[model samples]
Target chain A: MTMKIDCPFAAKILTVFIKEELAKFGFKKGVLGLSGGLDSTVCAFLAARALGPKNVLGLIMPYGTSFGEDVRDAIGAARLLKIRHKTIDVAPMVDAYFKKYPTENRVLRGNKIARERMSILYDFSGREKALILGTSNKTELLIGYGTIHGDLASAINPMGDLYKTQVRQMARYLEVPAKIQKKLPTAGLWTGQTDEGEIGMTYAELDEILFHLVDERESKEELLARGFPRAKIEKIMSKIKSSEFKRQLPPIAKISSRTIGHDFLYPYDWEK
Target chain B: MKIALAQISPHLGNIQRNFELHLQAIEKARREKAGLLVFPELSLTGYLLKDLVETAALDPDKSPMFKEFKALSRDISLVLGFVEEKSQEKGLFYNSAAFLDKGKVLHIHRKVFLPTSGMFDEGRFFAPGRNFRTFSTPHGKMGLLICRDFLHYAAGYLLFAGGSEIIIVASAAPGRGLAGKNGFATSRMWELMGEAISRFSSAFVIYCNRAGLEDGIVFAGGSFIFNPFGKRLVQAPYFKNDFLVQEVDPAEIRRARKNWPFKRDDKPEVILEALKRIVHDYED
Candidate 1:
């Protein structure tokens, strides 16, 4: 039940959305953390097409335990897109932070690594006068698979509405390298950390069911009647329901008659 | 029934320049051998006109540009959005759309809903219109809506009740909510509207939306056409100036209506009585 995404239409609007959104903030250039994954590669292609390769800056940050193949793929993506890119090793920073707060907690280490990469991307954003473009897809954002204030942090995100399956289609349409497109999806937070292994669901299955549940607004019984796995439907539905807060601006205390994020919620680009 | 949607980025307060753009688009559509061509709301005067609306109004009857449009319609029928200057009364205007063919205005629809809340200030710029009528065209019996009018269900219902075989909406919608790589959430919302009316009423639907940035607000320009079965026949590119030409079959409408006699079995008098009763009891 994989959805057939309209690739040409999606590509056109996304490229325009990226370029126009950037211009609204007076940014002619953009920055992104290229993980050599399908999502990042697709985003890099769109950004390059929108703002031209010279205006896009790709940062490839690999941890000490990251596979060398991932590094090669990231560099390959940058070269193919012909964007200004730099590879910065996050090993020293991740190691230094772990030394002070040593722990075997996988979640904490992953969070730290994500935040460190985010911090570096933001630094480059300021130095380069470029906005930070994001690579989080709809599935990851809906399920809270991304770390908050880490890789999820961005000035503007163009791919957030697309499902993982849709992302792959767009990547192939953008002509991303075969290595990046065929590679197993991973956050590279730790060695051998695959996204499907962590989420315990294939994107095609998740997207199909979610398309019905979210897009078609099908009820639980309706989904089960449609032949979706009961347990998988429950898992995906609960993840989306609980991660709602992450998709919104932080709640504000309503002491005044008008609150920035509440009563007086203005658009983010209102400043521009 | 070949229809063409010319999605152009109109310069604010420049009706002359926009008219020239329309001429170019009309020529392109003519070259494509299209039967009908449509443009977005205020395609002549760009959106967000607070102080410029007064100077932007064009008299559809007297304006020589409309004669040009009428002459062009001899080759290809045209639906265009412009600020219509109220002829009988000076200093009054309406956000209007004109249907032109064979050297005359076939119909003119002023926007019924003047959106005032949020970023829209149409109420401050022009007066709201009152009628929703369907008129004959070279292609089919067509109804016209200007932007916000299509957002209301009654607009479509009234047009359908008047025997509109096709509904054309000219919109100047700004893009918002970039939830994912899919572009504007605005697009999905509009698609839902177009799909429902096309299927339920067994009528063709043409939604022409503008593109490009307007004073920091980017117009999500995904102009598209849907057949009576709610199938998207053609789609224009979003966020850029573009056009699409597709041959529509009025027979699809006839087939859909014959299959589902919803239009045939409709009870318009009941709706009128209900609305009258509601209006009588309304306190607000």
Candidate 2:
């Protein structure tokens, strides 16, 4: 007898929720930063379906020395889906920042690039009166693989749960370009940088362990017994713990009868 | 028109449990003869489930919960939140809301604004929705806004421009009051939103919020209704399960809009001045 594994059809289900939520908000258009990666590609496909191609705006912001093929693939995917799209090169803006600051460190340069990209997305969202759709997946969010207030920012997200591997699976289902589907995951921060290569573990393994530790509440000893490297576990666990601040709103100091972060308890729709 | 605000709790990762709660609310609304019933944002699946939310999300077309909701739409119109599948493509999901009446889904709104800052990562698990239009119900033409959408003036303005007589906001706003210092500011933010809605459109506004704790983040249940003149008509208790039912007259909305004429006074200079204030450029 074979036992069936339950697959999260999360993307499909979230599409409906997003539609209804948008209706509730009285918004007619959605905008997203399409980075030609597995996450953004998946998000774009979902947004296109949820809001219709006419109402979805996909902005592709590429910095200097981006993988040319990947950008082309992003354009191709948008065309295939017939979603509204535009490409804005951030090389000039990024170069200006560096020229003004004169930073040679790749990490600093990468951080500036991420933040610049976010600023552009938010600015465009205002101009279009559209919501900014986020593209970070659960693996990145859990490990804080994203920059604070940068790629980690958006008005709403639809793929925070799927791991990199799961995002790849969904990408295939969405018919994303093969180049994007096969490309090694990267923040495109600098030349020749890949997420797994930098993190020292593949998403498949990381997601498996993270699920066990966070969702299943497995202990470190149990994880070690199950063949997870103790060092890797420690590193990942520490990252999750340290990054908890990033996952929360700014700490508020309560001083009133009904404070929001402290005593005020209500749903998003409590005023009806 | 009497509207019922359903500030009920939703079970985490449990679609069936939430659907039952919604059904119960519908029954209560019908018994009360409420013309409209509202629920909180993402009420079908408790907010901030992290990755668990994705696994538990349900497709609107195929979900039994959606079917039950449609069936419940006989005597009253209802608004509720759920995870829905995008019809045009595969593997796409949205944070969606549905307007159900007379056993049909009249309209569906996907959340266009996803909050990804600080404690919210809506941009992580849901896609943004598009299309701004008000729905015409027996009670009146009404507009809807979700949690973060109300923070932006453009969303409310669009609804007013679309001729909405009333605007309803559904939210699962995390309890800032639980935070020792910032609670008052958050509360003030909600109050300001109420004032903005009335001032901008001179239309009645209703906010329905959820209550309870999920994943240690408590919801601040300050659900309330504002008359067309921006006066508080009814307010619900915070941090607990509660409901409010109030009657609204369409004539009040017309009278308020006619009297204020704020939309007419909304010129480019006025907009520029407002933008300056929003950007904190008080020197101008």
Candidate 3:
């Protein structure tokens, strides 16, 4: 079952959220890592709409093994939105580090690239006096598909609650370039790496299962009865269980009566 | 009498700023020549305040703020929400709404139904109130219900039976779901309840909801006024602050009560006896 969202309504709420939340944090400008993927492109559109094109900046960071098409698309997305953008090749830093700590693992290389890109975005955020807008959708967040403290790091996320399929719908509504919207989602850590190829399932299938399991709170038995493969359901559940740490602040040992995350609970917007 | 609904965005845990905001709203309402101005739930302190509730709680009798509000009430009546500290019972707090009229604190209604399920933790913090009393005002007998209190049918029914002609609900309901055209699903839910209660009880229903984002939860600000016949008079837009004033004629209440007679035919004694037996049986 496709979960349909009212894109225009969602866009209105998200743009307002971006503008107001940023203003509350004493920020009128926003900076984001534009990967030319659906999620990042959608966020760029929202940021431009919220903070105005001049106030928004997109950083297109690429590694040596990154696809040329991906780089062009990122630049194209920024141009379409009429937001200021800069391209910084991160091959030297990532390659130099990997030379000393040599590894054939693709996941390790991808994690480093993700972290490197985020670091550049943060640096630009500080230099430009702007907040870093997040790009991770709910599907990647729940499945632990992205690197922690890497793509997951952001000041605020407008699209965090939206699923991947919903993000695609938003992309269409925002009139994001058809090339960027139709292209397979990739982190661009290396050539021929796609989110669906690595995850071994289409976003539609995963979103349906996740919508039922997470949003609807369907039990395993109920899922099986609804014609979902038991192995796939179990795999999704385990992924969610394992990725719980990425979604939360690191736990602190409770020594005092009032602990930060435990007894001493306060909203993040407190006193702001 | 003209009633003004002040849809405001309170700074979280910043009582001084929220106080200033309230003063501004009071000034605007007075300028608009409204007889009474109603604000959303916890207009003095923002919602989603987990640990700050204790810090924000104030004794209405001792606090100078209430004194100021009382002095301001000399010009126009006021109704607003705050975290009420029980002076006699230390460390206990109640999510309370106070009705100020003629330079005096007339009535205070602590929220009876503290929603503690599914993203809400009100029951964990606030002690549930035990009464649903109505107080007399210049317009008519009025009752105050917090956000969750209005959702309960019995709460509105009890107020209707207690001779209430106007039911004012101050709410901080977060926007949820996007299946509706006008506003969020949660917002639509409140409007339906407001319409139903106004029609059933033959009372004017005035709902004031807050605006702005607090910890990712956006308070839906579709504040509305419904006449005794359940016809919507005016509505503020969603997700934005607005000060809406609408003339509320008390004669509409008489006309509606005459047409429906829900109030005249209401049998509170039967309900009381049934509840007494049911509670005794359940406990036994």
Structural similarity to truth (TM-score) of each candidate: 0.66, 0.52, 0.98
DockQ of each: 0.05, 0.01, 0.65
Position A120, candidate 2: lDDT: 92
Candidate 1 residues lying further than 4 Å off, grouped into runs, are A268-272, B1-6, B9-39, B42-144, B148-168, B173-208, B212-239, B242-284
Best by DockQ: 3
Where is model 3 more than 4 Å wrong at Cα? none
Worst 10 residues of 3 chain B by lDDT: B177-186
TM-score of chain B of 1: 0.98
Better model by DockQ, 1 or 3? 3
Which ranges in model 2 have alpha carbons more than 4 Å from their true place? A1-8, A255-258, A269-272, B1-284
The TM-score obtained for chain B of candidate 2 when compared with the true chain B:
0.88
Put down candidate 2 lDDT per residue, A1-272, tens digits, no spaces.
11111123334344654554455456768888877778888888888888899898888888855667667877887898899999988999989877888978998888888899899988988898887878888888999988889899987677776667667767777777787788788898887999999999988788888878875679999999989999999999998988877677898888777777664544442211
Ranking by TM-score: 3, 1, 2
Please write out the lDDT profile of model 1 over residues A134-161, one tens digit for every residue.
9999889989899999989998888887
Using TM-score as the yardstick, the better of models 1 and 2 is: 1
Q: Which of 2 and 3 is ahead in TM-score? A: 3
Best by lDDT: 3
Candidate 2, residue B274: how far the Cα is off, in Å? 70
Candidate 2 local lDDT, B57-95, one digit each (tens): 666677776777888887789999877775554556677
